[model samples]
Target chain A: MNGSTSSQKHPLDGLLRTDRIPHIWCPGCGIGTVFSSSLIAIRSTGAEPMKTAVVSGIGCTGRGAGYVNLDSYHTTHGRAIPFATGMKLANPELSVVVFSGDGDLFAIGGNHFIHAARRNMDLTVICVNNLNYGMTGGQAAATTPYLAKTSTTPLGNPEAPFNLPLLAYACGATYIARWTMLHTRDLTQSITEALTRTGFSFIEVLAPCPTGYGRKNKLKASDLLKVYQEKAIVKNGANPAETILDLEQGITLGKFVEYDRPTFAQNYKAVTSD
Target chain B: MEPAVLTGEHFLNGDVACAEGALAAGCRFFAGYPITPATEIAEHMSKRLPQVGGVFIQMEDEISAMAAILGASCAGAKSMTATSGPGFSLMMENIGLGITMETPCVLVNVQRAGPSTGLPTLGAQGDMMQARWGSHGHYEIIALAPASPQEIFYQTITAFNLSETYRLPVLIMADEIVGHLSERVIIPDSSKIKLRSRPRPKGRKDRFLPYRPGANGVAPMAHAGEGYMVHFTGLTHDEKGYPVMTAEAQAEMVDRITGKIRKNLDRIIQVERYRLEDAEVALISYGISTRSSLAAVDEAREQGIKAGLLRLLTVWPFPEDMVRELAKRVKGLITVELNLGQIHLEVQRCAEGRAPVVLVGHAGGSVITPEEIVEKIKEQVG
Candidate 1:
């Protein structure tokens, strides 16, 4: 038989399950962009594919693990962090990454996210903040900005959204960064850096959910990207509390925290040795 | 370094014994939250696991603990967690995920009274049915009930073995009385102990299908970072571990999981019979009530009445065939338990009018008395 033709191959073919393409994300959704960027970052790290595992919680972003050609676990709703935490503790040699949606990682699984960060567990958490629950038909989520219309908040959401970078900073994450899908190069670079970091590293990608968070607000995918282009400011090392997102006010995007401390495994080893 | 098993007789409570048994069974990872009657298991594991080079984590809540064990199991460590009624309820969602993913792990429920935290320090068998059906979906489960510290020690090992062999979560249903009560437990030598491990994938790594079954209907498991590229999910999946959202896929998936246990009931079910031969009346009980029922059976025999006991060791997958055979020969079958009627309904269904089934039960907080069982036996027999 002749060798496989180049015409049939994609650039990131080896990193993804090509047969599982035509993924569940709707057109104009930014999850696919975030997922592809993550894979590129994983490849750039030169990490052994066999020694890396990806875990995801339930939602549109949760399907990221299934399409990746790695040891992937599509876990229950709001449980990816704890699951990845267990994997890291069980075998500290392996690199564990959790890829999930904003609602799953912040709303229902909020407790685990904070605790894992506080413990400085060795994990890379990629949170796709589409603002609303995209998979559940645009319901109001923990990251849904105030005055944004959603299925559950037709009149406009009254509850404030979480400033994720600030939350991660407050929870003692060793490395924290925020970027949008429009900044693919920076997002991929941020993920690459986070993957090599020793403690709990977090990257928040603000992506467009045109079908969920956009339709009611009369914003298309291009409009959202234009907003990011005009209002996004690169303010590295700015105070985390001052970096909250507001459509009217500019949204700051850059690495907010970077430091070194003993991870959970290192501390555990010390205690056991003592 | 700590020895795997103590290998000597020691008077220990049921919770401690369970922890020792897990360590002996090669369980190296434990994640649990503190709950009444089950907290001792976590405490014991915390002190002992580190010495044995095992990992012990006290999670923020029960949900995380359950999820953690599943993750640890996927990382090639035998993992377990312990909790009580409320915590057990919290674990139900993840337990279903475990069932769907076919992850081999052990969950010990040191049951306390509850309809929502009914009694924290007292024993109850109210969660027996919940252990089987609490998770939202159709699935089969294996749960073992232990009546004393010695039995819980042995049963904990059995739970791990069953989990490994069947590639599913196994439950240890120990009530509060059995959990806190102290008794002599003799842990056997490490070399003498038997352990079952999940089968490893045999074919080429590139072609390995995570959910493909073998002759026994159990798929070989490959741990994370093993170069298997295995994908596991809670959605209804095909043999390739790919999500298939169709009724036909659901039928095939649900049938294989439930059918594996149902088809192998003979190997999974365990019941102990005491003076069951040539009996006119049979007393069916499990957990703490089994001890009282045995005493009542002896009293009935001494009084020249032909009464015997059938003690269930494996509660789920209900030992229906054995009960049906026993029901055919007896005049009446009585189920004695701490709850009003849980396993009694199973016994009644299995009897199928071949014999009259009677329930001798109570609300909770304590074990049923032998005198009460004797009274029920007399009333049923007459």
Candidate 2:
């Protein structure tokens, strides 16, 4: 045992299940950075730890719920949003957050996402878009870019990816933003805003899946960060429809939609409470 | 405030009575997607839940409806959902999640006929086996079959009670005939109703193990936002509710969950016997078929045939010991159901060839009548 290890503790120790460490994430995976940023955002918000809950669907990023030292639930595939909705509606005092992956939020669970956003449910949905299914070994995902190479799409992806910002905006999400894991400060701030906001708040984070996605696309972990640093354009308040993600063109990053409307809980109370 | 139990006689269909039963049982959260036969339950809940300070939501689909109830139940609310065949099929995925996580919630499958949209408006008990093995993986579940609207009202409350005690999902497997039939239901006063709640964690909050079983082999539940900060997952987990990926851990988890009900079989399994005292022939049935079996038993007795009816109110942790005992005493056992020999197989297995087992089965879209069951009983007695 190292004597130094006993004296020094990580900063997020109070907010993490430190015993469950040596986490399942592979080396060079960007999910860790995004997860840490989320923890920091949750901590910084000063929300009551006891009253806050984290819900995640099945995926590599979904493991974030298990690590968080909160009243957390790791639910079935594509169901984090609905679970969060139920928790929030059942107890309005509790703050519910959904932390999951692109495929989980868009593929098997896509209908739930659309309906939750449409209801303007009070939830913070942080979707880590690795562009492919990381846990299942880099299969083509709903958000995989056209012509991108994955285990399921060796030649190239035939389907076009979903424009997450536009979908969130169209579905009535009150707050929407896009960022990369490399943009830790910006991503953290975006998450903090979503956590504090009412109604449906969505944040899409681009992350590097080195083992599952990078090798297939001939990009290293660092090369993926470089792509974000070089190609990402910071354009806050851009029309969601105008936000593009084509690598040859450029990646649009920043808050795209921010406003408020009566949330599902509020409307429920208004109608039900005589 | 609205009274939890409406203490008076009322004419109600089985579907509507089920909703009232849930409200009276302290079920405050209901999430369901519309499906035939069971749709009235949702409709009634939507109108009544709000009046009683409960929340009701019609989700996007059956899958989300099931997921939502699990989430609500975790947040310290008694939650439930109602659906039919197709919707029940969709709900199986999350129902498995509810079981593994040990979340207490009630699922009502007002079963209609179907492999796929076989007969949406018609009644059938074909989903009996599906209710037992619908969800993937190995786990024990509690399911109740109510023969009448009045029985459904009482059994729905019983379903919630069992779910709370066992810390698992309890199913009310009512058929379309029972769901749609109108009858008199007498809901007793709140003081007369027996309600059970899941055991809450005690002792030290700092050392709380959310999945640690007590003397009863069931872990005390600490709801979300109770300052315990418990973690729950659908994966096979340890006592601390952390995923433990090992065969040993898997065995331990499965054993504790299945064992809780297995050990307390007498308390969980409920059967109503009619004239079974001095009968030489036994007719075993449940749900709508139970009603027919009762009439058939009376008809057989008038014809000088010593016939008895054993109606299973609790169909799942099936009454194996009782069946075995009855098989030894009876000349033959006649199993009547709307399905093509689903629960009959269980009765046959439990009988162990001590007596002949005869199945009076149907193909769906209708209930097996008393005449049909009496005919089978006569043939079996001969």
Candidate 1 lDDT tens digits, A1-274: 5567976787888989888888999999999999999999999999999999999999999999999999999999999999998888998889899999999999999999999999999999999999999998999999999989999999999999999999998999999999999999999999999998799999999899999889989999889988888889988887888896877698899988899999888888889876
Per-residue lDDT of A65 in model 2:
92
Query: How many residue pairs of model 2 clash at the backbone?
Result: 0
Residue B364, candidate 1: how far off, in angstroms? 0.6
TM-score for chain A, prediction 1: 0.97
TM-score of chain A of each: 0.97, 0.97
Candidate 2: residue A52 Cα off by (Å): 0.8
Error of 2 at B323 (Å): 0.3
C-alpha positional error of residue B277 in candidate 1 after TM-score superposition, expressed in Å: 0.4
Interface RMSD measured for model 1: 0.5
Candidate 1 local lDDT, B244-313, one digit each (tens): 9999999999999998899899999999999998889999998888999999999999988899999999
Give the clashing pairs for model 1: none
Q: What TM-score fits each model?
A: 0.99, 0.99
Candidate 1 regions off by >4 Å?
Answer: A1-5
